[model samples]
Target: MTRALLLVDIQLDYFPGGAFPLAEPEAAAVAARTVLDSFRESGELVVHIFHVATAPDATFFVPETPGIGFHPAVAPLDGETTLEKHQPNSFIDTGLETVLREAGVTELVIVGMMSSMCIDSTTRAAHELGFVCTVVSDACAAPDLTLGETTVPGASVHAAFMAALDGSFATVTPSASLV
Candidate 1:
């Protein structure tokens, strides 16, 4: 099957010194970079999804801000496909499916930040849309989540989402095997 590397929101806003920095984002980016390098070497399709918030008083990923720019580790080259999305699901109104279909991409190698959100959302959407998906676990991160009086650490949150996505939505594996 044809494959494409789908990097979702690997931006500065999720890293150190930016808004809503995640736990171990540098590690995640480095892992994603390894996978990206492999894809580049193989001359495979690569898609970078950037989140640009349009709502007023948005906290992160706002338009015209450096925080919205891609992190250096996973930044796109001249020939790579770049897409700006407002929602967690990269395919939602981003023409990601159309692009993939046109390129004859049937399988996706997914990576990037906020595992509990974009990574989970996009992977589920991709599976439902009939694309075979493989999510790189170590190449994704998550912010700590809270529910009323309880708080969950980012590592736990990430593991929980990956567990939920594995086997059914997509095969969840680490970047080392992928690279």
Candidate 2:
């Protein structure tokens, strides 16, 4: 079966010095780039999924702002497919499924930002859509802001999300071994 790497929302707005920078953004991007480069060498499909905010004047991820662009470290090549979405789930209101189907992708190896939100949503959706999913743990990161004042730690939140997805929605693995 053919497999593809579905990188989600690795944009400027999600990195250090951006609007919603996550903890350990640089590490996550590096890990993702390493994994993607290896996959590209192997001739696997690499689709970069980016979120374009549908706001009028929002600086962070607005189409007009540079913050909406993909992060420099994880920039996709000319041959790679770029899927843009407004929702957290890449497949939602996007042609992601069609693109994957056209490329004969029966499985997906997912990696990217916001492990608890976009990562989680896409992983579960892809699994339900009948693709075998593998989530690159180190290549994904998240910040805990669910609880208002008594906020949880980002690392703890990332771990919990991975644990929840490990055996059910997807197989959680490190980027190093996957390539």
- The candidate that wins on TM-score is 1
Model 2, 70-100: lDDT tens per residue? Answer: 9888898998899889888899988999999
- Candidate that scores best on lDDT: 1
lDDT string, candidate 1, 8-117, tens digits: 99999999899889989999999999999999999999999999998999999989999999999999999899999999999999999999999999999999988999
User: Model 1 segments beyond 4 Å from truth?
Assistant: none
Collision pairs in model 2 = none
Would you estimate the TM-scores of all the predictions?
0.99, 0.95
Q: What is the Cα-based lDDT of residue 96 in candidate 2?
A: 93
Clashing residue pairs in candidate 1, if any? none
Write down the lDDT of every candidate, Cα atoms only: 0.96, 0.90
Residue 47, candidate 2: C-alpha displacement in angstroms: 0.3
